[model samples]
Target chain A: AQSVTQLDSQVPVFEEAPVELRCNYSSSVSVYLFWYVQYPNQGLQLLLKYLSGSTLVKGINGFEAEFNKSQTSFHLRKPSVHISDTAEYFCAVSDRTSTDKLIFGTGTRLQVFP
Target chain B: EAGVAQSPRYKIIEKRQSVAFWCNPISGHATLYWYQQILGQGPKLLIQFQNNGVVDDSQLPKDRFSAERLKGVDSTLKIQPAKLEDSAVYLCASSSLQGGEQYFGPGTRLTVT
Candidate 1:
């Protein structure tokens, strides 16, 4: 079985400050990792994904994540965030053998202050 | 392009009652999925469909939950004799291929009193 763990339940940051949401996964086989953002009353939007390329992956809204296989981590980072960046972020993992299923972490709530 | 669409944005039902939600996937999408998201928790996959055929439903509550995708485009999920634990946002998502980046719908919030 595959599982995702998000260490932080909530993260508070001021506008234009850097932010990092930590995520770790446990899987017996190779996996695909992804980050998704959900604003209030909206569905989740794909932030970025690590499929088969470089370790570094860039996503929308100026967010990026690095897939570290040794550490089993895919942490999302933003050099600078805006007020609008306040949202709930999720980390998901899909086993390469059974790609149809995705296991998501609890989620990290990013609260951006002025 | 339009994203995945779900109907009955909000639903309130009593325990022991039944409820249903609908979803219309993006045009040309070959895969559709249904997920359950509890408050403060990440979404959990309940079922998956591959063009009107069942692919994976291992996690779905077979006794109380039922879902179908007809014509390979639209799908419906129903819960009979709902329980308080079933009160959550039901999300619908679609993807062009299996294991691809999925586009999610706004989700239908279900509250069982």
Candidate 2:
């Protein structure tokens, strides 16, 4: 079985400040990693994904994540955040050798303040 | 392109009552999925459909939950005699490929009183 863990439940940052949301996963086999953002009462939107390329992947909205295989982690990063960036973020994993069934972590609420 | 669509954006029912949710996937999507998200938790897969056939339903509660995708476009999920634990957001997602990125719909929030 595969599982995802988001180390922080909530992260608070001021506008124009850098932000990082931590995520870790446990899987017996290789996996695909993804980060998704959800606005209030809205569905999730893909931030970025790591399928089969470089260790560092850039995503929408100036977000990026690095897939660290040795650490079993895929942490989302943003050099700067805006007030509109306040949303709930999720980390998901899918088994590489098996079906593309997403296993998601609880979530991290990003509260960008002015 | 239009994303996945789900009906009954909000549903409230008493315990033991039944409820159903409808979803319409993207025009050419070949894969559809249903997920349940409890409060403060991430979404959990309930079932997966490839066209009109079931691809995965291991986590779905067979006794109380049932889902079907007819004509490989529209889908429906039903829960009979709903429980309090079933109160959560039910999301529908679709993808062009089995391993492709899924586009999610605004979930149906079901509240069982």
Candidate 3:
């Protein structure tokens, strides 16, 4: 079985200020990690995924995340954020045993202030 | 490529009533999924279908919820005797290849009074 936990429920930051959203997971075996963003009144859109290779993965809109095995964390990072970045973000995990299904964390709301 | 499409973008019904939502997957996609998203929460998988066949439905509320992918193309989800707590957004997603990033539709937001 797999589960995800997004520690912060809401994160408020000023525009152009860097930010991080912490995500942790528990899986008996290897798992794939992903980050998704949803704007107000819209559906989720894939931001980035960790499948293999480099520990750091980058995605759309200057967003990136690092997959840390020892820490069991996949924290999303952004050097500079924009007002448009205000949205809800989710972290998800899927194990090698069942890649078809995903376990997602309760989302984190990002409020970027100008 | 075209994104997933869902009908009845918004629905309002009284308690004990029945409601249904529709979804059309992207062309040639072999996988379809239904998810429920309540206010202030991430979407939760309700059911999955592969080529018009059921793949996983562990989280589906079998007693009051049902879904079907008759033609392996578009799908429909139903909720009978809807309750106040049943108000939520029903999201439909599709993936061209299994285990890949899914494309989502605008979703049908249901409000039960």
Candidate 4:
């Protein structure tokens, strides 16, 4: 079984400032990590994933996450946040065998303010 | 290619009433998933299907919720005797066999009163 945890339930950041959303996971077997974003009233959008190899993974809309095996973390970071970056973000984990049932953490709401 | 598609978009039903939501997955994607998302919470998988056969339904409320993917192309989820807690956004997602991102639909929002 795999479980994901997003430490912060909400994060506020000033526009043009950098931001990070922390995520951690626990799994008995090797796993895949993913970040998903949700606009108001819309379905989730895939941001990026760490399936294998590289510790750092870049995603759409100027977001990236680092997969840290030692720390059990996959934190998302952005160089600069925009007002449009306000959205709900989710962290998820899945096993590698490819049956691929994702276990998601309670979302973290990002509020980018001007 | 079109993303996963779900309907009716919104539904309002009284307590104990029955409701149903539908979904059509992306072309050639063999895995389909149904999830429930309450406000301020991440999605919880309600069921998963692999080409018309159920692979996981451990979290589903079998007494009140039932789902099917008869043709392996389109699927439907039915909730009988709806509860206030059952009111939430129902999401549908699909992933191709290649093993990567899962495409999602604009989920159906259900409100039970």
Model 4 segments beyond 4 Å from truth?
Answer: none
DockQ order of candidates, top first: 1, 2, 3, 4
Please write out the lDDT profile of model 4 over residues B3-109, one tens digit for every residue.
89999999999999999999999999998999999987889989988889998899999999999999988999999989999989999999885355678899999
Q: Using TM-score, rank the candidates from best to worst.
A: 2, 1, 3, 4
Query: Residue A33 in model 3: shift from native, Å?
Result: 0.1
lDDT of 2 by residue, A4-35 (tens): 99999999999999999999999999899999
Q: Which stretches in model 2 have alpha-carbon errors above 4 Å?
A: none
Worst 10 residues of 1 chain B by lDDT: B94-103
Estimate, for each residue in A11-89, the C-alpha lDDT of model 4 and write its tens digit.
9999999999999999888898999999987899999999888899999999999999999999999999999999999
C-alpha lDDT of all candidate models, in order: 0.96, 0.95, 0.93, 0.92
Measured over the true interface residues after superposition, the C-alpha RMSD of each candidate is 0.8, 1.1, 1.1, 1.9
The docking category that best describes candidate 4 is medium
lDDT of 3: 0.93
lDDT tens readout by residue for model 1, B13-88: 9999999999999999999999999998999999999999999999999999999998999999999989999999
Q: Per model, state how many residue pairs clash.
A: 0, 0, 0, 0
Clashes of 1: 0
lDDT of 1 at A95: 88
Best-first order by lDDT = 1, 2, 3, 4
DockQ of predicted model 4: 0.68
**Which candidate would rank higher by lDDT, 1 or 3?**
1
